[model samples]
Target: MSKATTSKARILAAATAIAVEHGPKQLTLDNVAKKCGLSKGGLMHHFSSKEALLKSMTENMLHKLEEHGELLKTRHSDALTITNVIRTKKFINEIIGMNEAKILLVAAIENRELLSSVKAAMLEQKEAIMSEPKSEMATLLMLAADGLAFQELLGISPFDENERNQIGDKLIDMAIALEGDLHE
Candidate 1:
Protein backbone atom coordinates (compact mmCIF):
# COMPACT_ATOMS: atom_id res chain seq x y z
CA MET A 1 0.00 0.00 0.00
CA SER A 2 1.04 3.58 -0.42
CA LYS A 3 2.16 5.61 2.57
CA ALA A 4 -1.17 7.40 2.62
CA THR A 5 -3.06 4.13 2.68
CA THR A 6 -0.85 2.81 5.44
CA SER A 7 -1.33 5.96 7.47
CA LYS A 8 -5.08 5.86 7.06
CA ALA A 9 -5.12 2.23 8.10
CA ARG A 10 -3.00 3.04 11.12
CA ILE A 11 -5.40 5.79 12.13
CA LEU A 12 -8.40 3.49 11.88
CA ALA A 13 -6.67 0.73 13.81
CA ALA A 14 -5.53 3.14 16.49
CA ALA A 15 -8.95 4.71 16.73
CA THR A 16 -10.52 1.32 17.13
CA ALA A 17 -8.14 0.40 19.92
CA ILE A 18 -8.75 3.65 21.75
CA ALA A 19 -12.49 3.48 21.26
CA VAL A 20 -12.49 -0.03 22.63
CA GLU A 21 -10.36 0.83 25.65
CA HIS A 22 -12.07 4.10 26.31
CA GLY A 23 -15.52 5.03 25.08
CA PRO A 24 -16.28 6.86 21.85
CA LYS A 25 -16.93 9.91 24.04
CA GLN A 26 -13.26 9.77 24.91
CA LEU A 27 -11.93 9.59 21.35
CA THR A 28 -9.77 12.58 20.47
CA LEU A 29 -7.35 13.51 17.73
CA ASP A 30 -4.43 13.83 20.15
CA ASN A 31 -5.02 10.38 21.60
CA VAL A 32 -5.38 8.79 18.16
CA ALA A 33 -2.30 10.65 16.94
CA LYS A 34 -0.22 9.51 19.91
CA LYS A 35 -1.43 5.95 19.56
CA CYS A 36 -0.53 5.83 15.86
CA GLY A 37 2.82 7.61 16.34
CA LEU A 38 1.72 10.37 14.01
CA SER A 39 2.26 14.02 14.74
CA LYS A 40 -0.94 16.02 15.20
CA GLY A 41 -0.19 17.80 11.97
CA GLY A 42 0.21 14.51 10.16
CA LEU A 43 -3.04 13.19 11.52
CA MET A 44 -4.78 16.42 10.72
CA HIS A 45 -3.53 16.21 7.17
CA HIS A 46 -5.44 12.96 6.80
CA PHE A 47 -8.50 13.73 8.94
CA SER A 48 -9.20 17.37 9.55
CA SER A 49 -11.77 16.80 12.25
CA LYS A 50 -13.05 14.18 14.67
CA GLU A 51 -16.29 13.90 12.67
CA ALA A 52 -14.28 13.15 9.55
CA LEU A 53 -12.24 10.56 11.34
CA LEU A 54 -15.34 8.86 12.71
CA LYS A 55 -16.91 8.84 9.28
CA SER A 56 -13.78 7.30 7.79
CA MET A 57 -13.64 4.68 10.52
CA THR A 58 -17.25 3.74 9.87
CA GLU A 59 -16.64 3.38 6.15
CA ASN A 60 -13.47 1.41 6.75
CA MET A 61 -15.32 -1.10 8.88
CA LEU A 62 -18.11 -1.50 6.31
CA HIS A 63 -15.57 -1.97 3.55
CA LYS A 64 -13.82 -4.67 5.53
CA LEU A 65 -17.14 -6.48 6.01
CA GLU A 66 -17.91 -6.11 2.32
CA GLU A 67 -14.69 -8.02 1.74
CA HIS A 68 -15.97 -10.72 4.06
CA GLY A 69 -19.26 -10.78 2.14
CA GLU A 70 -17.31 -11.52 -1.02
CA LEU A 71 -15.28 -14.20 0.74
CA LEU A 72 -18.46 -15.83 1.99
CA LYS A 73 -19.88 -15.97 -1.53
CA THR A 74 -16.88 -18.09 -2.59
CA ARG A 75 -16.20 -20.06 0.58
CA HIS A 76 -19.57 -21.12 1.85
CA SER A 77 -21.81 -23.69 0.20
CA ASP A 78 -25.06 -23.13 2.08
CA ALA A 79 -26.77 -20.51 4.22
CA LEU A 80 -24.14 -17.92 3.52
CA THR A 81 -26.39 -15.09 4.61
CA ILE A 82 -26.95 -16.21 8.15
CA THR A 83 -23.58 -17.87 8.43
CA ASN A 84 -21.79 -14.75 7.27
CA VAL A 85 -23.60 -12.54 9.74
CA ILE A 86 -22.82 -14.93 12.58
CA ARG A 87 -19.24 -15.24 11.44
CA THR A 88 -18.87 -11.50 11.07
CA LYS A 89 -20.02 -10.99 14.64
CA LYS A 90 -17.55 -13.61 15.75
CA PHE A 91 -14.79 -11.97 13.75
CA ILE A 92 -15.57 -8.59 15.30
CA ASN A 93 -15.59 -10.02 18.80
CA GLU A 94 -12.33 -11.81 18.22
CA ILE A 95 -10.44 -9.20 16.24
CA ILE A 96 -11.93 -5.84 17.12
CA GLY A 97 -12.77 -6.49 20.75
CA MET A 98 -16.36 -6.17 21.95
CA ASN A 99 -15.77 -3.03 23.94
CA GLU A 100 -14.44 -1.24 20.90
CA ALA A 101 -17.34 -2.50 18.85
CA LYS A 102 -19.81 -1.17 21.40
CA ILE A 103 -18.19 2.24 21.35
CA LEU A 104 -18.07 2.35 17.56
CA LEU A 105 -21.65 1.12 17.33
CA VAL A 106 -22.88 3.81 19.63
CA ALA A 107 -20.94 6.48 17.81
CA ALA A 108 -22.12 5.32 14.43
CA ILE A 109 -25.72 5.33 15.59
CA GLU A 110 -25.33 8.92 16.63
CA ASN A 111 -24.59 9.72 13.00
CA ARG A 112 -27.91 9.70 11.13
CA GLU A 113 -26.60 8.64 7.75
CA LEU A 114 -24.37 5.96 9.18
CA LEU A 115 -27.15 4.59 11.35
CA SER A 116 -29.45 4.35 8.34
CA SER A 117 -26.89 2.36 6.42
CA VAL A 118 -26.37 0.03 9.34
CA LYS A 119 -30.08 -0.47 9.84
CA ALA A 120 -30.59 -1.13 6.15
CA ALA A 121 -27.86 -3.74 6.12
CA MET A 122 -29.32 -5.44 9.16
CA LEU A 123 -32.73 -5.52 7.60
CA GLU A 124 -31.46 -6.76 4.26
CA GLN A 125 -29.44 -9.57 5.77
CA LYS A 126 -32.19 -10.71 8.07
CA GLU A 127 -34.77 -10.63 5.31
CA ALA A 128 -32.53 -12.66 3.02
CA ILE A 129 -31.97 -15.36 5.61
CA MET A 130 -35.55 -15.34 6.79
CA SER A 131 -36.72 -15.94 3.24
CA GLU A 132 -35.90 -19.60 3.75
CA PRO A 133 -38.54 -20.60 6.36
CA LYS A 134 -39.43 -20.04 9.96
CA SER A 135 -38.54 -16.51 9.00
CA GLU A 136 -39.75 -15.03 12.25
CA MET A 137 -37.57 -17.44 14.19
CA ALA A 138 -34.59 -16.53 12.09
CA THR A 139 -35.23 -12.87 12.75
CA LEU A 140 -35.50 -13.58 16.44
CA LEU A 141 -32.23 -15.46 16.36
CA MET A 142 -30.53 -12.54 14.70
CA LEU A 143 -31.94 -10.06 17.19
CA ALA A 144 -31.02 -12.26 20.16
CA ALA A 145 -27.46 -12.63 18.93
CA ASP A 146 -27.15 -8.88 18.56
CA GLY A 147 -28.67 -8.38 21.99
CA LEU A 148 -26.13 -10.67 23.62
CA ALA A 149 -23.24 -8.95 21.94
CA PHE A 150 -24.50 -5.51 22.86
CA GLN A 151 -25.12 -6.54 26.42
CA GLU A 152 -21.66 -7.92 26.72
CA LEU A 153 -20.16 -4.87 25.10
CA LEU A 154 -22.06 -2.46 27.32
CA GLY A 155 -21.25 -4.33 30.53
CA ILE A 156 -24.93 -4.94 30.97
CA SER A 157 -24.87 -8.42 32.47
CA PRO A 158 -21.57 -9.25 30.90
CA PHE A 159 -21.04 -12.92 30.38
CA ASP A 160 -18.14 -14.94 31.68
CA GLU A 161 -16.22 -17.13 29.25
CA ASN A 162 -18.38 -20.11 30.07
CA GLU A 163 -21.53 -18.07 29.79
CA ARG A 164 -20.47 -16.70 26.44
CA ASN A 165 -19.74 -20.18 25.18
CA GLN A 166 -23.05 -21.45 26.42
CA ILE A 167 -24.91 -18.62 24.77
CA GLY A 168 -23.15 -19.26 21.48
CA ASP A 169 -23.98 -22.93 21.64
CA LYS A 170 -27.58 -22.12 22.35
CA LEU A 171 -27.74 -19.80 19.37
CA ILE A 172 -26.38 -22.55 17.16
CA ASP A 173 -29.03 -24.91 18.47
CA MET A 174 -31.68 -22.31 17.79
CA ALA A 175 -30.48 -21.92 14.23
CA ILE A 176 -30.55 -25.66 13.70
CA ALA A 177 -34.03 -25.92 15.04
CA LEU A 178 -35.21 -23.11 12.81
CA GLU A 179 -33.65 -24.79 9.80
CA GLY A 180 -35.45 -28.00 10.59
CA ASP A 181 -38.76 -26.24 10.92
CA LEU A 182 -38.26 -24.40 7.67
CA HIS A 183 -37.38 -27.56 5.76
CA GLU A 184 -40.22 -29.56 7.16
Candidate 2:
Protein backbone atom coordinates (compact mmCIF):
# COMPACT_ATOMS: atom_id res chain seq x y z
CA MET A 1 0.00 0.00 0.00
CA SER A 2 1.03 3.59 -0.45
CA LYS A 3 2.20 5.65 2.53
CA ALA A 4 -1.08 7.50 2.79
CA THR A 5 -3.07 4.28 2.69
CA THR A 6 -0.88 2.74 5.35
CA SER A 7 -1.10 5.85 7.50
CA LYS A 8 -4.87 6.06 7.17
CA ALA A 9 -5.16 2.39 8.08
CA ARG A 10 -2.97 2.95 11.08
CA ILE A 11 -5.09 5.87 12.11
CA LEU A 12 -8.26 3.82 11.77
CA ALA A 13 -6.79 0.93 13.71
CA ALA A 14 -5.75 3.22 16.53
CA ALA A 15 -9.09 4.96 16.55
CA THR A 16 -10.98 1.67 16.77
CA ALA A 17 -8.76 0.41 19.57
CA ILE A 18 -9.33 3.56 21.55
CA ALA A 19 -13.04 3.38 20.96
CA VAL A 20 -13.20 -0.27 21.93
CA GLU A 21 -11.08 0.16 25.01
CA HIS A 22 -12.48 3.41 26.33
CA GLY A 23 -15.69 4.02 24.35
CA PRO A 24 -16.41 6.39 21.47
CA LYS A 25 -16.53 9.40 23.73
CA GLN A 26 -12.82 8.93 24.28
CA LEU A 27 -12.02 8.90 20.58
CA THR A 28 -10.38 12.06 19.34
CA LEU A 29 -7.86 13.03 16.69
CA ASP A 30 -5.28 13.89 19.32
CA ASN A 31 -5.91 10.63 21.14
CA VAL A 32 -5.77 8.64 17.92
CA ALA A 33 -2.60 10.39 16.85
CA LYS A 34 -1.04 9.56 20.21
CA LYS A 35 -2.16 5.93 20.00
CA CYS A 36 -0.89 5.53 16.43
CA GLY A 37 2.29 7.51 17.00
CA LEU A 38 1.30 10.07 14.39
CA SER A 39 1.23 13.79 14.86
CA LYS A 40 -2.20 15.38 15.15
CA GLY A 41 -1.57 17.09 11.84
CA GLY A 42 -0.74 13.78 10.21
CA LEU A 43 -3.95 12.22 11.45
CA MET A 44 -5.94 15.20 10.32
CA HIS A 45 -4.34 14.86 6.92
CA HIS A 46 -6.46 11.70 6.51
CA PHE A 47 -9.61 12.32 8.60
CA SER A 48 -10.55 15.93 8.99
CA SER A 49 -13.25 15.38 11.60
CA LYS A 50 -14.79 12.73 13.81
CA GLU A 51 -17.74 12.38 11.46
CA ALA A 52 -15.42 11.68 8.55
CA LEU A 53 -13.54 9.10 10.61
CA LEU A 54 -16.77 7.36 11.70
CA LYS A 55 -18.01 7.33 8.12
CA SER A 56 -14.78 5.69 6.98
CA MET A 57 -15.01 3.08 9.73
CA THR A 58 -18.52 2.03 8.71
CA GLU A 59 -17.66 2.01 4.99
CA ASN A 60 -14.56 -0.02 5.71
CA MET A 61 -16.71 -2.89 6.96
CA LEU A 62 -18.98 -2.81 3.91
CA HIS A 63 -16.00 -2.51 1.55
CA LYS A 64 -14.46 -5.73 2.84
CA LEU A 65 -17.72 -7.63 2.25
CA GLU A 66 -18.20 -6.00 -1.17
CA GLU A 67 -14.71 -7.08 -2.18
CA HIS A 68 -15.67 -10.69 -1.46
CA GLY A 69 -19.03 -10.18 -3.22
CA GLU A 70 -17.16 -9.12 -6.39
CA LEU A 71 -15.27 -12.42 -6.47
CA LEU A 72 -18.45 -14.40 -5.83
CA LYS A 73 -20.25 -12.59 -8.63
CA THR A 74 -17.58 -13.63 -11.14
CA ARG A 75 -17.82 -17.31 -10.20
CA HIS A 76 -21.57 -17.76 -9.82
CA SER A 77 -22.44 -15.57 -12.85
CA ASP A 78 -26.22 -15.75 -12.34
CA ALA A 79 -26.46 -16.21 -8.58
CA LEU A 80 -27.07 -12.60 -7.72
CA THR A 81 -29.42 -13.47 -4.88
CA ILE A 82 -26.99 -15.97 -3.40
CA THR A 83 -24.35 -13.26 -3.41
CA ASN A 84 -26.51 -11.25 -1.02
CA VAL A 85 -26.70 -14.17 1.34
CA ILE A 86 -22.95 -14.61 1.21
CA ARG A 87 -22.42 -10.93 1.84
CA THR A 88 -24.72 -11.11 4.84
CA LYS A 89 -22.77 -14.09 6.14
CA LYS A 90 -19.52 -12.22 5.68
CA PHE A 91 -20.96 -9.18 7.44
CA ILE A 92 -22.11 -11.31 10.37
CA ASN A 93 -18.68 -12.91 10.56
CA GLU A 94 -17.09 -9.47 10.58
CA ILE A 95 -19.00 -8.45 13.69
CA ILE A 96 -19.20 -11.67 15.68
CA GLY A 97 -16.38 -12.05 18.20
CA MET A 98 -14.65 -8.93 16.88
CA ASN A 99 -14.04 -6.16 19.40
CA GLU A 100 -13.29 -3.56 16.78
CA ALA A 101 -16.47 -4.47 14.94
CA LYS A 102 -18.51 -4.30 18.10
CA ILE A 103 -17.08 -0.88 18.86
CA LEU A 104 -17.61 0.38 15.36
CA LEU A 105 -21.19 -0.92 15.43
CA VAL A 106 -21.86 0.89 18.67
CA ALA A 107 -20.35 4.02 17.22
CA ALA A 108 -22.54 3.72 14.17
CA ILE A 109 -25.61 3.24 16.32
CA GLU A 110 -24.73 6.35 18.27
CA ASN A 111 -24.27 8.26 15.05
CA ARG A 112 -27.20 7.01 12.97
CA GLU A 113 -26.39 9.28 10.04
CA LEU A 114 -23.05 7.55 9.61
CA LEU A 115 -24.91 4.31 8.85
CA SER A 116 -26.24 5.57 5.49
CA SER A 117 -23.59 3.66 3.54
CA VAL A 118 -24.48 0.43 5.30
CA LYS A 119 -28.19 1.08 4.71
CA ALA A 120 -27.46 1.68 1.05
CA ALA A 121 -25.61 -1.58 0.75
CA MET A 122 -28.50 -3.39 2.43
CA LEU A 123 -30.99 -1.74 0.09
CA GLU A 124 -28.98 -2.90 -2.90
CA GLN A 125 -28.93 -6.46 -1.61
CA LYS A 126 -32.66 -6.34 -0.87
CA GLU A 127 -33.36 -5.08 -4.36
CA ALA A 128 -31.40 -7.93 -5.91
CA ILE A 129 -33.10 -10.55 -3.75
CA MET A 130 -36.56 -9.08 -4.29
CA SER A 131 -36.06 -9.48 -8.01
CA GLU A 132 -35.52 -13.23 -7.56
CA PRO A 133 -38.26 -15.87 -7.95
CA LYS A 134 -37.51 -17.30 -4.50
CA SER A 135 -37.35 -13.90 -2.92
CA GLU A 136 -39.13 -14.88 0.30
CA MET A 137 -36.53 -17.47 1.08
CA ALA A 138 -33.73 -15.05 0.28
CA THR A 139 -35.39 -12.37 2.36
CA LEU A 140 -35.66 -14.79 5.25
CA LEU A 141 -31.94 -15.49 4.97
CA MET A 142 -31.13 -11.82 4.97
CA LEU A 143 -33.37 -11.22 7.97
CA ALA A 144 -31.69 -14.07 9.82
CA ALA A 145 -28.32 -12.49 9.21
CA ASP A 146 -29.57 -9.09 10.27
CA GLY A 147 -31.05 -10.61 13.42
CA LEU A 148 -27.75 -12.30 14.17
CA ALA A 149 -25.95 -8.97 13.83
CA PHE A 150 -28.43 -7.27 16.13
CA GLN A 151 -28.08 -10.06 18.67
CA GLU A 152 -24.36 -9.53 18.79
CA LEU A 153 -24.55 -5.78 18.45
CA LEU A 154 -26.88 -5.61 21.44
CA GLY A 155 -25.06 -8.31 23.44
CA ILE A 156 -28.20 -10.43 23.53
CA SER A 157 -27.01 -13.54 21.72
CA PRO A 158 -29.41 -16.35 22.51
CA PHE A 159 -27.45 -19.17 20.89
CA ASP A 160 -24.10 -20.74 21.63
CA GLU A 161 -21.35 -20.40 19.06
CA ASN A 162 -21.95 -23.85 17.57
CA GLU A 163 -25.67 -23.29 17.15
CA ARG A 164 -25.14 -19.91 15.50
CA ASN A 165 -22.61 -21.42 13.11
CA GLN A 166 -25.04 -24.17 12.21
CA ILE A 167 -27.74 -21.64 11.43
CA GLY A 168 -25.39 -19.57 9.31
CA ASP A 169 -24.22 -22.60 7.35
CA LYS A 170 -27.77 -23.72 6.73
CA LEU A 171 -28.76 -20.28 5.48
CA ILE A 172 -25.89 -20.24 3.00
CA ASP A 173 -26.82 -23.72 1.81
CA MET A 174 -30.40 -22.63 1.30
CA ALA A 175 -29.29 -19.55 -0.59
CA ILE A 176 -27.04 -21.62 -2.83
CA ALA A 177 -29.85 -24.04 -3.56
CA LEU A 178 -31.93 -21.11 -4.78
CA GLU A 179 -29.58 -20.73 -7.75
CA GLY A 180 -31.09 -23.69 -9.54
CA ASP A 181 -34.60 -22.45 -8.76
CA LEU A 182 -33.76 -19.12 -10.33
CA HIS A 183 -33.15 -20.76 -13.70
CA GLU A 184 -36.11 -23.12 -13.52
Candidate 3:
Protein backbone atom coordinates (compact mmCIF):
# COMPACT_ATOMS: atom_id res chain seq x y z
CA MET A 1 0.00 0.00 0.00
CA SER A 2 0.97 3.63 -0.41
CA LYS A 3 2.58 5.46 2.51
CA ALA A 4 -0.49 7.65 3.06
CA THR A 5 -2.78 4.65 2.93
CA THR A 6 -0.60 2.76 5.40
CA SER A 7 -0.51 5.75 7.74
CA LYS A 8 -4.26 6.17 7.61
CA ALA A 9 -4.79 2.47 8.28
CA ARG A 10 -2.39 2.55 11.21
CA ILE A 11 -4.21 5.55 12.63
CA LEU A 12 -7.55 3.80 12.32
CA ALA A 13 -6.19 0.62 13.87
CA ALA A 14 -4.72 2.53 16.80
CA ALA A 15 -7.96 4.41 17.31
CA THR A 16 -9.96 1.19 17.29
CA ALA A 17 -7.59 -0.41 19.80
CA ILE A 18 -7.94 2.59 22.09
CA ALA A 19 -11.72 2.46 21.85
CA VAL A 20 -11.79 -1.25 22.58
CA GLU A 21 -9.26 -1.14 25.41
CA HIS A 22 -10.16 2.10 27.18
CA GLY A 23 -13.70 2.66 25.95
CA PRO A 24 -14.84 5.24 23.40
CA LYS A 25 -14.97 8.00 25.99
CA GLN A 26 -11.23 7.63 26.41
CA LEU A 27 -10.39 7.72 22.73
CA THR A 28 -8.64 10.92 21.65
CA LEU A 29 -6.44 11.99 18.80
CA ASP A 30 -3.51 12.35 21.15
CA ASN A 31 -3.95 8.83 22.49
CA VAL A 32 -4.27 7.46 18.98
CA ALA A 33 -1.15 9.34 17.89
CA LYS A 34 0.80 8.07 20.88
CA LYS A 35 -0.36 4.52 20.25
CA CYS A 36 0.46 4.80 16.57
CA GLY A 37 3.87 6.38 17.27
CA LEU A 38 2.89 9.46 15.30
CA SER A 39 2.93 13.08 16.38
CA LYS A 40 -0.44 14.66 16.99
CA GLY A 41 0.12 16.82 13.92
CA GLY A 42 0.66 13.73 11.80
CA LEU A 43 -2.45 12.09 13.18
CA MET A 44 -4.39 15.25 12.44
CA HIS A 45 -3.17 15.14 8.90
CA HIS A 46 -4.96 11.80 8.54
CA PHE A 47 -7.89 12.40 10.95
CA SER A 48 -8.70 15.92 11.93
CA SER A 49 -10.65 14.92 15.03
CA LYS A 50 -11.72 11.98 17.12
CA GLU A 51 -15.08 12.06 15.43
CA ALA A 52 -13.43 11.84 12.03
CA LEU A 53 -11.44 8.85 13.14
CA LEU A 54 -14.47 7.07 14.53
CA LYS A 55 -16.45 7.86 11.40
CA SER A 56 -13.75 6.39 9.22
CA MET A 57 -13.59 3.30 11.40
CA THR A 58 -17.33 2.83 11.11
CA GLU A 59 -17.19 3.25 7.35
CA ASN A 60 -14.36 0.73 7.16
CA MET A 61 -16.43 -1.76 9.13
CA LEU A 62 -19.30 -1.36 6.69
CA HIS A 63 -16.98 -1.74 3.72
CA LYS A 64 -15.55 -4.96 5.15
CA LEU A 65 -19.03 -6.34 5.63
CA GLU A 66 -19.94 -5.51 2.05
CA GLU A 67 -16.80 -7.24 0.86
CA HIS A 68 -17.67 -10.34 2.84
CA GLY A 69 -21.17 -10.28 1.36
CA GLU A 70 -19.67 -10.28 -2.12
CA LEU A 71 -17.45 -13.22 -1.22
CA LEU A 72 -20.54 -15.07 -0.02
CA LYS A 73 -22.17 -14.49 -3.42
CA THR A 74 -19.29 -16.23 -5.12
CA ARG A 75 -19.24 -19.10 -2.64
CA HIS A 76 -23.00 -19.71 -2.33
CA SER A 77 -24.43 -18.12 -5.52
CA ASP A 78 -27.20 -16.50 -3.41
CA ALA A 79 -25.76 -13.86 -1.16
CA LEU A 80 -29.02 -13.02 0.55
CA THR A 81 -30.04 -16.58 1.25
CA ILE A 82 -30.03 -18.21 4.67
CA THR A 83 -27.28 -20.57 3.59
CA ASN A 84 -24.92 -17.74 2.75
CA VAL A 85 -25.70 -15.88 5.96
CA ILE A 86 -25.21 -18.99 8.03
CA ARG A 87 -21.93 -19.76 6.33
CA THR A 88 -20.39 -16.37 7.10
CA LYS A 89 -17.20 -17.58 8.76
CA LYS A 90 -15.20 -14.41 8.22
CA PHE A 91 -18.03 -12.21 9.46
CA ILE A 92 -18.62 -14.49 12.42
CA ASN A 93 -14.94 -14.27 13.37
CA GLU A 94 -14.99 -10.51 13.06
CA ILE A 95 -18.18 -10.20 15.07
CA ILE A 96 -16.78 -12.33 17.84
CA GLY A 97 -13.14 -11.25 17.94
CA MET A 98 -12.69 -7.84 16.29
CA ASN A 99 -13.06 -4.46 17.92
CA GLU A 100 -15.00 -2.90 15.05
CA ALA A 101 -18.39 -3.75 16.56
CA LYS A 102 -17.32 -2.45 19.94
CA ILE A 103 -16.03 0.72 18.35
CA LEU A 104 -19.31 1.27 16.53
CA LEU A 105 -21.29 0.68 19.71
CA VAL A 106 -19.19 3.24 21.57
CA ALA A 107 -19.43 5.70 18.69
CA ALA A 108 -23.18 5.35 18.48
CA ILE A 109 -23.54 6.03 22.18
CA GLU A 110 -21.17 8.99 22.03
CA ASN A 111 -22.53 10.49 18.82
CA ARG A 112 -25.62 9.09 17.19
CA GLU A 113 -24.98 11.15 14.05
CA LEU A 114 -21.83 9.16 13.34
CA LEU A 115 -23.92 6.03 12.76
CA SER A 116 -26.34 7.44 10.20
CA SER A 117 -24.50 5.79 7.36
CA VAL A 118 -24.22 2.52 9.24
CA LYS A 119 -27.92 2.49 9.90
CA ALA A 120 -28.61 3.18 6.25
CA ALA A 121 -26.35 0.36 5.15
CA MET A 122 -28.02 -2.04 7.57
CA LEU A 123 -31.45 -0.98 6.33
CA GLU A 124 -30.39 -1.58 2.74
CA GLN A 125 -29.20 -5.08 3.59
CA LYS A 126 -32.42 -5.79 5.48
CA GLU A 127 -34.48 -4.70 2.51
CA ALA A 128 -32.56 -7.04 0.25
CA ILE A 129 -33.03 -9.96 2.64
CA MET A 130 -36.72 -9.16 3.03
CA SER A 131 -37.17 -9.44 -0.72
CA GLU A 132 -35.68 -12.93 -0.82
CA PRO A 133 -37.94 -15.94 -1.37
CA LYS A 134 -36.90 -17.40 2.00
CA SER A 135 -37.09 -14.15 3.85
CA GLU A 136 -38.18 -15.73 7.13
CA MET A 137 -35.27 -18.14 7.10
CA ALA A 138 -32.89 -15.37 6.22
CA THR A 139 -34.19 -13.25 9.09
CA LEU A 140 -33.86 -16.16 11.50
CA LEU A 141 -30.29 -16.83 10.46
CA MET A 142 -29.39 -13.18 10.78
CA LEU A 143 -31.01 -12.92 14.18
CA ALA A 144 -29.10 -15.93 15.41
CA ALA A 145 -25.84 -14.42 14.21
CA ASP A 146 -26.68 -11.06 15.74
CA GLY A 147 -27.56 -12.67 19.03
CA LEU A 148 -24.22 -14.43 19.17
CA ALA A 149 -22.45 -11.21 18.24
CA PHE A 150 -24.22 -9.23 20.93
CA GLN A 151 -23.47 -11.82 23.54
CA GLU A 152 -19.82 -11.88 22.55
CA LEU A 153 -19.54 -8.12 22.36
CA LEU A 154 -20.96 -7.76 25.85
CA GLY A 155 -18.78 -10.62 27.16
CA ILE A 156 -21.91 -12.41 28.24
CA SER A 157 -21.82 -15.41 25.98
CA PRO A 158 -22.40 -18.58 27.98
CA PHE A 159 -21.37 -21.02 25.32
CA ASP A 160 -17.97 -22.61 25.49
CA GLU A 161 -16.09 -23.25 22.27
CA ASN A 162 -17.52 -26.73 21.83
CA GLU A 163 -21.02 -25.54 22.56
CA ARG A 164 -20.72 -22.62 20.19
CA ASN A 165 -19.47 -24.93 17.48
CA GLN A 166 -22.36 -27.33 18.08
CA ILE A 167 -24.83 -24.49 17.82
CA GLY A 168 -23.20 -23.25 14.62
CA ASP A 169 -23.27 -26.72 13.09
CA LYS A 170 -26.95 -27.08 13.91
CA LEU A 171 -27.68 -23.75 12.29
CA ILE A 172 -25.73 -24.75 9.19
CA ASP A 173 -27.74 -27.93 8.93
CA MET A 174 -30.95 -25.95 9.15
CA ALA A 175 -29.71 -23.62 6.43
CA ILE A 176 -28.82 -26.56 4.21
CA ALA A 177 -32.31 -27.98 4.70
CA LEU A 178 -33.85 -24.64 3.87
CA GLU A 179 -31.80 -24.43 0.70
CA GLY A 180 -32.91 -27.89 -0.30
CA ASP A 181 -36.52 -26.98 0.22
CA LEU A 182 -36.10 -23.89 -1.90
CA HIS A 183 -34.56 -25.87 -4.69
CA GLU A 184 -37.38 -28.41 -4.63
Cα lDDT tens digits for candidate 2, 31-64: 9989999888888889998888888877876776
Query: Candidate 1 clashing pairs?
Result: 20-100
Which pairs clash inside model 3? Answer: none
Query: After TM-score superposition, what is the CA distance of residue 135 in candidate 1 from its true location, in Å?
Result: 0.9
lDDT of 1 by residue, 1-184 (tens): 9999999999988988888777777688999999999999999999998878887877676677677667755765445356556656665565655654554564665565655555677778877986766667767777888888878777775688578757866776667665556556
In terms of TM-score, which candidate is strongest? 3
Whole-model lDDT, model 2 = 0.74
lDDT of 2 at 108: 65
Which pairs clash (backbone N, Cα, C closer than 3 Å) in model 2? none
lDDT of 3: 0.77
TM-score of each: 0.82, 0.84, 0.88
Once model 1 is optimally superposed onto the true structure by TM-score, how far is the C-alpha of residue 75 displaced, in angstroms?
Answer: 4.8
Candidate 2 regions with alpha-carbon error over 4 angstroms = 74-80, 87-97
lDDT scores of the candidates, listed in order: 0.72, 0.74, 0.77
